[model samples]
Target: MTISDYASLLADAGDYSGRDDVAHLFPRFLALAELKLNRVMRVADMEKTATVPLAEGEGSLPAAFLEARQVLGADGRALRALPLQEFNSNGTSAGAPIGYAIVGAAIRVRPKGGENIRLTYYAKIPPLTAEAPSNWLIEKAPDVYLYALVEEIAIWERDAAKAGAAEALKRQAMAGLGLADERLRWGNAEIVIGGLTP
Candidate 1:
């Protein structure tokens, strides 16, 4: 669904006068929903990988970066992730970087140089708009967005009954989202090992 479609749903759920009123508020509600979703789950859509060159022990993270997954050198070995304080104190050893720290918008690594490193991370979801058209949440779990906006709209209108209904729908959608996330994270396969009989 698109942003306009979500606005229409919000108007219908809240029984608002028209879409124009809700249209203006769509971005705000969508932003709130995005923030909540970003914090709650790490979906496949949020994963991103980039090759960035470290200059003098640090390199800038992508604009949409939310959290780091892993950092690897050219050899494809995982670089240990360190706290900011530790990285600050031990970031200048010779040879390849042994670890990295996310400080501000940049990633600081040990033994910094101009060498490129692969960064895997979860990125923030892009907001939906008329120009932007759609996002992963819209394509995957649109009801989650719909219910989220409806709940917010109900609170704004001060309708207790409507807010309650919207809240229920939001919870249902969240449960579905959790299930989807789990399935995506771990596929439907059971691991069995047999070594000794008891």
Candidate 2:
């Protein structure tokens, strides 16, 4: 389903098609929907990898980065991210980074140097738009998106009954997501326990 499709459902939920109050809030609803989906499930589509330049004991995370899953060196060896105190204790001039730390918006590495590092992480899902009418949530499990949007709208309108119904739907969608995730895990026998399942 597209954003427009979800919006149509929302409109029919409360007859909001022409209501300026609801129409104006559709964008906000969509934003809330994406946020909720991100919180509820991790889809393969949101997994991303980016190369970050390490300099001055740090590297900038990608703009769309949500949370780091792992960091790898040029040779593809996993680099452990260090605790803040450990990284700080090692001092900024430490030769080669044995680990990294998420310091504010930047990644602080131990033994900082100039090397391009690979960061694997969950990415922030792009909001749906007219031109870019769909996303992972819309394609894989639009019910989750639809229910989340409806829940947001219900809360915005202060309709307790509607909000409760939407919440139930959201739970149902989450259950489906969990089953899908487990199925993927079960199908891939050689997958690393803590690594990405393919």
Candidate 3:
């Protein structure tokens, strides 16, 4: 659904709950829902790949980056994730990176040197707005958006019962989204135990 449609639905919920006085807050509700979704939802739709240039073995993560799934070197070798302390203790030496740690918004590589690295990560869901009314989640799982918005509205109203109910529904919708993504990723695949032959 588009942002307009989502806002209209939220307004309808607000009216039902006698919250028309806060109609002006619908945009805030939408933003809050997106924030919550970004924290909890990790479906395939959020996955993104980017090539980041490292200067002296340090580079900035993508602006929309949520969490890194994998990092590969210029020659396509996978780099290991290291704890910040371990990475720091490794000291600075200009060479190929063997591991990396996320330091704030930037990525720090061990044995630092400048090179372009490919990163696969989960990216934040694009927020809904007047100009950009829809996104993958809204298109594929409108119910998730609707229920999440309702939960936000419930919280704003300070109604615990309503908030709990809306949260339950939102989680159910999100589970459906997760199942759909799993099916897309592993379609008709049979599970094998320890790779043993039947």
Candidate 4:
């Protein structure tokens, strides 16, 4: 199926979020998601190209994630802890990731003459962490993990960023009052980025 066809199916994830077991079933979903991508992407290429719902299995994820969880709770764990990342976009959404690698993306599928295409994919970038996380460690799965997956994806937000293009940079000069360089602020559980001027 084209990305569009797959997208339509995921568009309704929020409807399923009603299930309280989203976390417990994350791993299985990862496996299934991997399987689904295998139909389009290569199996050996999964690690760098994209990530799936890998919680508990034979292998381990980036080391930092485990550490961050202890202090920040799950929300603090970021996808950048992994290394050697690559990206692929499947749509034309404005909020879509421009340069950041998303942990997972939202996919919407559209059917074209019986062929399904992925219309848009929302790229959910992992939060950046200051140091390597240590609390979370690579461990074998417990005997009973339902669906073998957990972590239901946040419902597919639209992919709003343009592809292979960036907003035009203007040469107009402006007087700086108090701007700093590369400002990053984390407030109310969200990262806000801007230029720091001084």
Query: Quick one: best TM-score, which candidate?
Result: 3
Q: Of the candidates numbered 3 and 4, which has the greater lDDT value?
A: 3
Clashing pairs in 2: 81-100, 94-111
Candidate closer to the true structure by lDDT (higher is better), 2 or 3: 3
- Local distance difference test values of all predictions, in order: 0.76, 0.74, 0.85, 0.23
Measured with C-alpha atoms, the lDDT of residue 44 in candidate 3 is 92
Which candidate model has the greater lDDT, 1 or 2?
Answer: 1
lDDT, model 4, position 195: 96
- Model 4 segments more than 4 A misplaced: 1-17, 42-198
In candidate 3, what are the lDDT values of residues 1-198, reduced to their tens digit?
243455555655565455777668878998999999999999899999999999888899999999999999987889999987888877666567889999889997887878899999999999877667668887788878888888888898799999999999999999999999999999899986786675
Model 2 residue 127 CA deviation in Å:
0.4
Q: Model 4's lDDT to the true fold?
A: 0.23
Summed backbone clashes in each candidate are 0, 2, 0, 47
Candidate 4 residue 196 Cα shift, in angstroms, is 61
Best by lDDT: 3
Order by lDDT, highest first: 3, 1, 2, 4
How are the candidates ranked when ordered by TM-score, highest leading?
A: 3, 2, 1, 4
Q: What TM-score would every model get versus the actual structure?
A: 0.80, 0.82, 0.88, 0.17
TM-score of 2: 0.82
- Write one digit per residue (lDDT tens) for candidate 4, span 15-91: 33344434344434544533432233211111222232222111123321211111111222322222223333322
After TM-score superposition, the amount by which residue 185's alpha carbon in candidate 2 deviates from its true location, in angstroms, is 3.9
lDDT (tens digit, per residue) of candidate 1 on 83-106: 777776775567878888888899
